[model samples]
Target: MPYDLPDDLAKLSLLDIAEAVAARRLPPVDQWHPGEVIDSKMRISADGTWYHEGSPIRRSAMIRAFSSLLMHDAADSRYYLVTPQCRQHIDVEDAPFLAVQMEHKDSALAFRLNTDEFVIAGPENPLRAEGDPDCPAIYLAVRHGCEARLNRSTWLELAHWALDRSDDLSVTSMGAHFSLQPK
Candidate 1:
């Protein structure tokens, strides 16, 4: 349960991000109370250290970044957290979802484009929005699965990444900040 952070992503606020996503993904879990719930497989330093097992937590971190958001959104709706296996992970039935999983050895979070507001998992994206360079970027390109860890930064990063690729980036960009509410 020990984890670390990558140099570039060592400075974000995971607690705030996780809180925001919890409110949306796991109402049952979120209702447990207000505190930190590190992913079962990962361990964060109480001393605020950003390093996992002496290595940087990048891919895993990305997963955590998105989970921070998706967990909150997973409530009420039917969505699947992509296992660190394939790209066919998400299963949205309504407007809510919460799923957390480990990053596969190959390092990938894959998802097919669907839904107006969607949570995507893939290796990475290579395309850009049609008009704006400031528009979000596509950093995901997995064929059918999402890889993730519970590192806080990863959850936030992926959410931001999704917003980047989003066609509605103009509208979503404003609400991209992490939130702390009830799931």
Candidate 2:
């Protein structure tokens, strides 16, 4: 069977793409090994806003769809959107996606990402805090090595919840311990 590559990626709805990804129907982008490079005027800001040509990418669905294509190149330590035939670089100011909402799951804190994926914090996917001690930033591992920054408000909520745990500033989720401070 021929691999189904959409004719127009921008025209596809985010929900449809998310569903396909959830079903494991897409190819492993990391294995594509395409050498083509396309320069895009796209950048993802610190707050998870996508910008094109210095203007915000207003469509939520478009952002979600593009997020699905995001990949990190370990060889060069850069981020790209990789398709089977081509690869394009995108500037990520902080993280690709934002953890907009969170849920209390059984022994875990499930985060609902901006791209509509729910990730449960665990040993495989640990949370880390970086940056200044006064303003530490929270990040959640998404897939591969890509991470999503928890928005300021969401971080605050997590901090509040962490306070109840202990003074060392760690939380246990799904039988794994994650530190609020960088290790």
**TM-score of each candidate structure, all chains considered together:** 0.19, 0.82
lDDT of each: 0.29, 0.76
Residue 71's lDDT in candidate 2: 86
Q: Per-prediction RMSD in angstroms?
A: 16.7, 7.2
What tens digits encode model 2's per-residue C-alpha lDDT throughout 1-183?
333343232343444434443675444776787879997779999887899999999877777677778888788888898888889989999888898766554577777787666677778778888988778888998875689999878788888888876887778887988888864
lDDT of 2: 0.76
For candidate 1, write residues 24-106 as lDDT tens digits: 33213223333333332332232222233454445644444434333322343322333232112233222221222222112
Report the C-alpha displacement of residue 29, candidate 1, in angstroms. Answer: 23
Residue 5 deviation, candidate 1, in Å?
1.2
